[model samples]
Structures are given as structure tokens and as C-alpha cells.
Target: MKPGQQDNMREDIYQEIQKQKAMSREKEAVGKLAGRIMHDFNNVIGAIEGYAALISSETADPVVREDAEQIRAICAKASRLTKELRNIAAPWEPESESRSSETTAVLSDKKVSCKILLVEDEDSLRKASTRILSKVGYQVFEAENAEQAFEIFKKENPDILFTDIVMPGKSGTELARELKDSKPRLKVLFTSGYVNEKGKIEEINSNTGLFIHKPYDYEALMKMIGGLCAEAQA
Candidate 1:
């Protein structure tokens, strides 16, 4: 093959690899979201099962008892599916106990002193992110949208705003802008799964940092949180 043709082939191969990598990342994100939903749904089902059992025992009427029994049976089926989900969602659960214990001890001493408001529209992502931040010793308040986030911000007066760039109601950029207008010193960290051709994310205040991509691991999350907190303290 000619040199130019060889170079073109190599470029094509590189692009293909990049495409594959992106697809793999997307698949991983979907799996993570599925796991989160399964875990939360399992908890809800457990609550329902408990209530149904209580009703079954307390109800004097045979009819009511039968109804409660039916509910319990339905919850049992849901429980089985959630268990499968847990298996998929936390395939690495067995390996993390030691790491988690060590991490907890380390975090126990290094106590992060900043209050953070975390806003994400997706319930799974919001819950997962909140749990990670809380585990790492940061005080994290979560919200599903910009409106709810504003309410929390008012009550919490959090030192930092860690928000998803795209959200229902008002976008993260708008929320950050409005809040910064009032509290100019407020440090912000933006996160998102998508960005448009218009560069909407780049519109976030010049004082703030770039977007942290979605599906971040705990280490990346901690790094972002640490950076934002350190900036605020400085």
C-alpha cells in the first residue's frame, strides 16, 4: 500500500477504536443505572412487604387478611427480581469490603468540613452521588432539579454547588448563574452525560470549572469534591 493510504487506514482504525470505547462506556453507564434502580426498588418492595405483613397480622377480617397475603406474594416476586439486579449491580461487592473499611477509617479522620448541594435529575445518579460524598465525610444535600436545589441552597447555604449540567426546569448553568449573582464566592462543579453543539456547558460562569463527565467512579468524584472544597476554603 502507498504511504498515504496506510496513514488513512491507521486513522480509520483509530476512529473505530475510539467509537468502540465510547460504546463500552455507555453500556457500563446503563448497567450502573440499572443497578441503582434495582437497589432502590428493592428497598421500596421491602417496605411494602413489611406493611402487608403487619396488616395481615393486625386485621381481624378474613377478607383483609387475604388481600394482605396477596400483596405479600406479589412483593416476593419483585424481591426475587431485585435480588438478581443486586447481583448484576454489585458484582464487585465481595471485593470492596476491605477497601471500604480502610477508606472509612481514613475518611473518619480527615473529615471534610464543606457543605455541598448536589443536583441531578436522575434519581439513581443523585442517590449514588450523594452516598459517595456522604461516605467521604462531606455534608451533601441532594435535589432532583434546579428548583429543589435552590430551596436546599437557601436552607443549607452550602459552600459548593455540584450539579448535573442538564436538568429539568432550569439547567445547571442557569441555577449556578442565579445563585452566584447572590453569592459571588460560591464555588461550582458541573457534571453531565451530554453537551450540545451550542456549548451550553461552556456558558457556566467563568469563575467555575469545566464539566465532569457522567459515570464517574468514586475516585474521580472525590477528586472533584476535594478540588471544589479546597478552592472554597482558599
Candidate 2:
């Protein structure tokens, strides 16, 4: 090869190595942070859960029992947050517990009247998620896959759409482009248990907001939705 060509190839290899190193370093840092958080949360959650269980076993007083129940509820919320963060901190690993005790902390005191389009291939996950979201006051429209999601998007014109990244047919990213073409301001949230080489959602447009990873807790999910929708409205 010519001297110029050889130099160019060398530079390319060096750049690639640097990029890989950076990615590795970032992953290590994230993993460390996740471990620390999980450790701390486990201690807190265990104590609270244990105490709640004890209180429930012994207490006959309604007020005290109610307080213990409240403690248990708070602990549950913390546990969900910990799990979701752990998921974000490590994309490759899977969480066994399918259920997430996540809640949408609606920003506004007034009614949160926003339409939601949910596109997911997994039947049980879809149904469970739809139920959870609907119960939380989000008017959710369901789609088994991205194709159906698109049809529903046009028909429904939902404020925010949530979809799975990995699908048998059209991927969520492709569907996102189509949806944005028609509804330019439409908000999107992409979730995936399996991420690509880029981590979670591939072909991410920087202009687009957050891409929520799969196994996200209700709190994290709602926070994203609230922030994105709120930004759109603003």
C-alpha cells in the first residue's frame, strides 16, 4: 500500500481502538455505580420489608397497621427504582421478575389527559403493561406489533407512543420514522430487553428524546413520559 493509504489505515485503527476503550471504560463505571446502588437499596428494602411483615403479623391497631403498610408501599417503590436503574446501568442482564411496581408521578395537579399508543409483540407483557398504564389514567391504545402500531397511530393520533425495539417485522425505529413523518411532534419511547451494538435502541436520532430500556419500572417510565409530553406541550 502507498504511504498515505498506510497512514490512513493506521489512524482508522487507532480511532477504533480509542472508541472501544472509551466504551469499555464507560461500561465499567456504570456497572460499578449500579452495584453500589443495588447494594444500598437491598439493605434498605430488606429492613423495611422485614419490619412491614413483622408489623402486619403483630399489629391490631388500624393506624399503626396503616403506617406499616405505607412503609411497605414506599419500600416497594424504592425497590422498583433500584431495579430499573440496575437495568439501565447494565443492558445485557435480564431481571427475572416480570412485574414492576412503577408509578407515573403526574407533574400537573390537574387531570393528565394524554393518549398513549403501546406497540409490543409479547402478549403477556403487552397485556400486563397495558393494564398497568391504563389503570394509571393513561388512555392506552394497544398494538401487537409495529405495523398495527402505525395504523393505530394515524387513527388515534395519540400524544405519546411506546414500542418495543426488537420485533419480527418492522422495528420500532422504522415505525418511529413513519410516525414522525406524519405526526412531527409525536413523542416516542423505545423499550428493549435486548439491545443492539449501540446498547438499546439503534438508529437513534439525537433530536428525539430519551429511549427507555426494557424492564423499566413504572416510576422511570412515567417520568420519561411526563417530561417528554411536558416538553412537547411547552
Candidate 3:
């Protein structure tokens, strides 16, 4: 074979290998993302199941019970399919958000950084989050769960409430609604391991402005908190 022809053939072979590698990498990324999404969905399903069981036994009102049961059924189906359809199938991951930018922006010009009430059931996370906020020049109040957070919120009336959605007694979503009901202008920043399942946050109006997902780095969390808290103030 001519030398030029040999070079062309080698180039063709290299290009084919690169294409296969790209496909393989994409497949791997999708697989990991699907697994993470399913795990979060299961957490939401568990919460719904527990809530339904309580409503079934405790509530005398048939209307409330019916609504609870419907929620339970929908979440159960979502859980089942999230596990079964491992790939990007029709029954799975229809609601996943596109990959958002990693950058987190600060809110408008403000001198005294907003006071933050950090509510998380996990102790390690609570402490770590507190230090992060403090480093960012905010006064931080720490609470282990939603109930404690409520007490703090009442006393401190901190500029912003930072809470975890999946907590023991009172979830973050419920807390946000409760606060907003009492004080229409309450500022809340809710974080979650389960953002997609049940649309727990879709109902959030302007009062509850920001959401941070699990495993978010320090910079991103602060930027989100700063921006939302600034907006709430404005």
C-alpha cells in the first residue's frame, strides 16, 4: 500500500475508536445519573407512604384521606418505574431538569449579610453548613429538625430560613407553607435530596425562592442563599 493510503487508513481506525469511546462515556454518565435520580425518588415515595398511613388512621375527614391515598398511589408507581426502567425510558425520568450551570450568584448589594437559620436533621451536615455560612459573613442559627427550626424562627426571626426538605417530624415544604401562611413575606431557602419527586417545590411561590440539592459545594450553596435572600429583601 502507498504511504499516503496507509496514513488515511490509520486515521479512519482512530476516528472509529474515538466515536466508540464517546458513546461508552455517555452511557456511563446516564447510568450514574439514573441511579441517583431513582434514589431521590424513593426517598420521596417513602415520605408519601408514611403520610398516607397516618391520614388513613388519624383523619376523620374522608376528603383528606382520599387526597392522601391518591398521593400515595402516584408516588408508589413512580418509585416502581424509577427502578425498573434503568435507561432513559418513557416511564422513567420524564421530569428530570436539564443540567444547570454550576455557578452560583450573589444577590444585590447588601452590607450586613442575611441572618440564616439552618435546619437539618443530620448533625454533621448542620455543623458543616453553619461554618460555611459563617465564613460567608452571615450570622447562623442552627437547628437539628423542623420543630426546632420553628422555635428558632419565632424567636430569632432570622432574615432567611435554610431548611432540609426531608426531615423527621415536619418537612421543609410544610414548614415553608406554615411560615408563609402566618407571615406572608417569609423568606425561605429549601434544600432537598428529592427535588423532582412529588413536585414538593413546584407549589412554592415567590416567598420560598431558592432550592439547593444535596452534595452541593460550599460556594454554590452560599451564592444561591445570597441571591435568594437578597431578592427576598428587595
TM-score of each candidate structure, all chains considered together? 0.54, 0.55, 0.53
Q: What tens digits encode model 3's per-residue C-alpha lDDT throughout 1-234? A: 999999999999999999999998887677667656754555455444444544544567888877766765665466446545533422322232222222112211234567888887766556656654664478899998878888888888887788877778987878877877776766787765444343554544434456654433344665667776777679
lDDT of 1 by residue, 1-234 (tens): 999999999999999999999998887787778755654554455445445554555568999988877876776666556545545554433211110111222223357889999887766557655655675578999889988988998899998998877666898888888988878888888765434323563475353654554433234456667887998899
Tell me how far the alpha carbon of residue 181 in candidate 3 is from the true structure, in angstroms, after superposition: 2.0
Ranking by lDDT: 2, 1, 3
Error of 1 at 194 (Å): 0.7
Superior candidate under TM-score, 1 versus 3? 1
TM-score of predicted model 1?
Answer: 0.54
Which candidate number maximizes TM-score?
2
lDDT (10s digit) by residue, model 2, range 98-190:
333323222223346688898877665666566555554678899988878878887899988787767779987778878888888988887
Q: How accurate locally is residue 25 in candidate 3, as Cα lDDT from 0 to 100? A: 86
